[model samples]
Target: MSGRAENMIQLIDVSKEYKMADSCRVALQHINLTISEGEYIGILGLNQSGKSTLARLLNGLLKPTTGQVLINGMATDSPQEIRQIRQLLGMVFQNPDNQLICPVVEEEIAFGPENLGLPPEEVNKRVDWALELVGMQEMRYHAPHLLSGGQKQKVALASVLAMQPRYLVLDEPTSMLDPLSRREILEHLCRINQENHITIILISHHPEDLLDAKRLILLHEGSIYMQGTPKEVFKDMEKLKAIGLKRPGLYQLIQQVEEEGYRIDDNIKTIPQLVEMICRI
Candidate 1:
């Protein structure tokens, strides 16, 4: 589905700096970006490359040291506007254990709307909807701590969804889960973006997780090194390796096959596509 053409989030010349005891470190430097409504964007970078810093800036968790972060035309730098900005942006972190607060799954999902002083009826409606959206309706009474890592992440996601934010910023939300769980979370995110019309900003290191994104942004040393579609970005294996990122195994294998003087389609992404190319050869 195509996102609304207008900019939903804008970062204009944004930079973030942290002041240590004796020195100041720049986490992001003069970064400018625009995210349209309902867009699915993946952010990739090595450790300390400012991925998390960028996420925080989008949600008003951290103010930019120099530039402005605008959420739907509202500036996040204003203290009074931070709350409003946060209501429009929801953030899911890497660890679900740290984010889930309530004991039961249902309460955890309702916590956000309850804090907003929503009526009990509205809160229940939101809780029910969020639970169903994440496919955790059966686990409403389950203890979050006892659930598997993937289930816990889903609950955490439900909590964020209950808030009904226009934008969702995920900071490596699946890093702790197993591969199956990671895929589940990513699939749910895609559904959320497409069906729910929520803009998704996913920060992940896994190439597979980024394949479905409409755009991919690569960060290096606090700057945007490259930004493009997954096919466009991953085409340059040497550049990805230089940035401490690896090409998908399938892509690497395709490269090797090409080197052996075999003709293969470079644009192929899925296994079936590869199989068809091999059969044709």
Candidate 2:
């Protein structure tokens, strides 16, 4: 959700399809997108709107059945080819436990670089840097099973970042955390993007999650329904509601104010921003 704006990955005529019992199940179609480096994009849409499938395509987990996902000018094919692409792109999942296959935290973070055949010094350096990046260095020796839900997810992200991936593909990375923990994880991610200039592509449903995006893209029925800066996209409150997307609580309050005969800009995107606008008015 709330994201930065920088593109690092590009998709050219990307599409995905699966064979069903009697017909073909098309998951994505003609997804032509450009993800600039160091940008954080919040991808939202209804279920089965190709959000998840799109995330899989970014880091090469699932290859497009039709087109190609170009990662830093390289074409990817299998999981092995993907391994090379992943050197620049990293993916974090919704469920941290599923991603945390190893028992210890450091081991999980090291798995990626080790697989890439880096020297022990390099792996150790990455492990240290990534842990420090996510503020998880102290827990490197802890058991994954013993960590909190938010901690686990952060650890998963650190594992990916340790690979020094310039592009980070996150599929609902905060979905499972409690509200406070969710905020914490998102804040840390924002710091990573701002300070480290890492590109972030986040797939999420919550409008609140998208508050920080330099851009927001909504995928609907296998196509882009809408896309713009959060202020632009969230302005279409009625349209978003029609698509089962809830506006932020602050937005709803502003809508209420407008209906009550108050003159409002109707373009406010966040609670604090709205407050500032109202104060000046």
Candidate 3:
């Protein structure tokens, strides 16, 4: 939980550019990053900040225009390794509907392993395990369309988890949900990363969603502007404000209380923790 496993996703001098009839656009520029196995990281950026482009580049959905993307030393651009790379690195999108293709929940969870040519018995085991992992075993027979937004997202996550990927990259996954649903999804992600030891690269614009991340990578206009722990990055209110991101509500409150001559632990995350600290004072 403190350090990471050996395998890594390396991006070296990577850039992505789009070409139209008469002009070109750069989504990412000379980006370099390394994601180690079992590490939970957050990628933060505003809209059009190349967060989605970066996520797609991880699983070989998009090739970098300039440099290299290597998954455990296998180049993502290689036709032979792209399939394996994708299998090792699963992706979840902003909309659950976009990823949940199968009609039933169990089938959706089984789809990845089934396509991997796993044995029927193995596939069934994976399906059951994934459903339980996401706490969706009771809804295994439910239709995807009938489920709530949060349930649908859980099914989508279970579908990816069924494949047993070494790394999971999610792009604005909780953006479409209500606050409670969003919190639920983020909590599930924390549990998934901690319990299963799967490396998680969570891409989102919301600072609140990334509070559980072990490391934070802040992207501004497609380049990494800052990288640190959530405590380190969120404490710089002026810098975050300049980048169009606000400090999380809880952190803001902590700062305000501290400014009023109260001491709060740096690890305080919830309102109850702050309340307890105040009561102690």
Q: Ten-residue segment with the worst summed lDDT in candidate 2?
A: 1-10
The TM-score obtained by model 1 is 0.91
Top candidate when judged by lDDT against the true structure: 3
Q: After superposition, how far is residue 164 of candidate 2 from its true place, in Å?
A: 0.6
Q: Deviation in angstroms for 201 in model 3?
A: 0.8
Tens digits of lDDT, candidate 3, 120-214: 99999999989888889999999999999999999999999999999999999999999998988888888889899999999999888998898
lDDT of 1 at 200: 92
Candidate 1 residue-wise lDDT, 202-251, digit = tens: 99877777777889999999999999988678778888878778877776
Model 2, runs deviating above 4 Å: 1-7, 78-81, 253-273
The residue-level lDDT of candidate 3 at 193 comes to: 90
Rank the models by lDDT, top first: 3, 1, 2
Estimate TM-scores for all models: 0.91, 0.87, 0.94
Which tens-of-lDDT digit does each residue in 1-281 have in candidate 2?
12222234667788899778899988888888887887888898878889998987777777789887777666665555676777788889899989898989999999998998999999999999999988898999999889999999989999999888888888888989999888888888888889999987888977787777778999988888899987678779888878888777876777666677777664565678778877786
Q: Kindly give the stretch of ten consecutive residues in candidate 3 with the minimal lDDT sum.
A: 1-10
